[model samples]
Target: MSADNEIVELKSHNSNFILNIFTDDYKKAIDNIKQKFERGSLLKDISVINSINAKDLNIIDIQRIKDFLKTELNIDYKEKKIIKKNTKEPKKEILKENIPKVVKADILEDDNYKTKIIKSPLRSGASVSYDGNILVIGDVNAGAELIASGSIIVLGVLRGFANAGAKGDKKAMVIANKIVATQLRIAEFIAIPPKDDKKSYSGVQMALIKEKGIEIQQVN
Candidate 1:
């Protein structure tokens, strides 16, 4: 198979992290998974992983990979059923006729496994936690807390405790229009602004993990 055909695609939907395996070869699938792990491209905090296109694999092969993933990476594995279209039906032809089309409204729903948006400000004593990114439309007042497995973005000032990359993703960042947070954290690293520090920053600011530490920088 070509290199592109051997690649594995990972996607998240409704709290399920799905791995789409293109090739049915067991060895190639294992190698591809290992490569992704080594490159730190996989999410380690997810409890379950759903595999697509794995129906052709035998029971033994499936069990082997399941054990490897659960034992080595602490991630559960499941094979999803493939939905196939009916191939025995004949094609139908449509006559050239004018028909009125029905228009429907498209309802947008929030996917809890992806980013979550908060429309109101976080008052003191308020706490929020999510498995994915978080977008806050208002200020995060002091004594409030925000924790996310992914990144966190604040449209207003962030003055409370905010922890991004709570699942240990070092690449995640925390961004805000103005940040004077009591404490900021990315992955396992934490940075607390001095109590006496009263410096103001201009424009949007971002805090990310750099050299095993959290660094705050102004975003242009």
Candidate 2:
């Protein structure tokens, strides 16, 4: 299973430990915690963890885990509240009301900006190039190539080569339902998947430029 799907993952930040719980399987979680303590992997210097981040667990389950930790190992930790990202749609009327009279102006669509949508799957040896955004409705088989000046969005699996921001737009992003791509590029940066990687993913994923380089993350 992927790390994201693991029952628990322990990480340290600024010398403080944090327990990240991914599932509500109380027994499995407790077993994993026991193993960690038995192996002296996480607890060596401190008896307290900073907090527990359990987004997928309920209050009862969380309390049960906390009780188990306190009673079994005498360890104590805080429960960190999950803060969800805001995703509300912006209201146009509110925007207009807040705009200054001097700054009022018409918003015109960019005539030069375009998006290309393909309805068919890209087979091996197939090559597609678009000056603007590219959207593929089907899977991109290995050996296929896609180049776009803007962003690239694949509705199905992407196992080929994809180059976005071909004109050097560092802000461009690539998204796919399932990305097992051999290679991905955005602007001057490139990312190649590890050889013989057997990890499986369950959700949509995205690749974008980050401070360190191209970063792939599950799209929530």
Candidate 3:
């Protein structure tokens, strides 16, 4: 579902799809819907919020799944709005450490400042967003998405979709310990991992958007 408060999960039966009802307020919601949308077409495709669990089914089609929301749930599919990004270097930070006698300060600054650390696995249909850099010490699972205004670093496998410098900054970079994502985006460019490399990508890899295109490289 495109609505902010609702989510749609699909069930698979060969090529056909099954509908299930799942809602916080089932009676009120279904009554309201019946009085409004279904009043026109009693047999029209309708939303059935499953009282059962959503985790037990296998979803196959994203479009058909979305259609149920529009016809049955009154959910509007909003178009993604793209915004321009700034490339100016961000402010600085100095860390001071005093161990016994000496004083130490480490400078940290970049186009976008701050770092967010994620410690859990990103499941399908879930998304994470940050204003600065991101460091995920967990897996970015398929269908999950990560969006950052600055750089992004995934210390574990990245098999989902990710967007770095989502505000339009091309200077942003993404570093990961493993690469398995179907596609990665930097600014307006997109890159897909090579099909020839099914050997389970390991080590360090980095990607950036250039005049040529999205380029992946070893982080060495």
Report, for every candidate in turn, its global Cα lDDT versus the true structure.
0.67, 0.69, 0.57
Per-candidate TM-score against the hidden true structure: 0.48, 0.48, 0.49
Sorted on lDDT, highest at the top, how do the candidates line up?
2, 1, 3
Top candidate (TM-score):
3
lDDT of 1 by residue, 50-163 (tens): 654465554335445655676777776543434566545433323232211110010011122266778899999998887767778788999998888678878788999998
Once fitted onto the true fold, the runs of candidate 3 whose alpha carbons sit more than 4 angstroms away are: 1-111, 196-202
Q: Candidate 2: where is the Cα deviation over 4 Å?
A: 1-112, 195-202
Any idea what lDDT model 1 has? Answer: 0.67
For candidate 1, what is the TM-score? 0.48
Q: For residues 1-220, write the lDDT of model 2, one tens digit per residue.
A: 3355667877888766788877668778889888877887547555766677776665345545766776788876533334566466432322322322311221111132366778889999998887767778788999998888677878788999998766556667788777888898876577995553556666567788899599987854
lDDT value, candidate 2, whole model: 0.69
Ranking by TM-score: 3, 1, 2
lDDT of model 3, residue 3: 43
- Count backbone clashes in candidate 3: 7
Query: How large is the C-alpha RMSD of every model relative to the true structure?
Result: 16.3, 18.9, 13.2
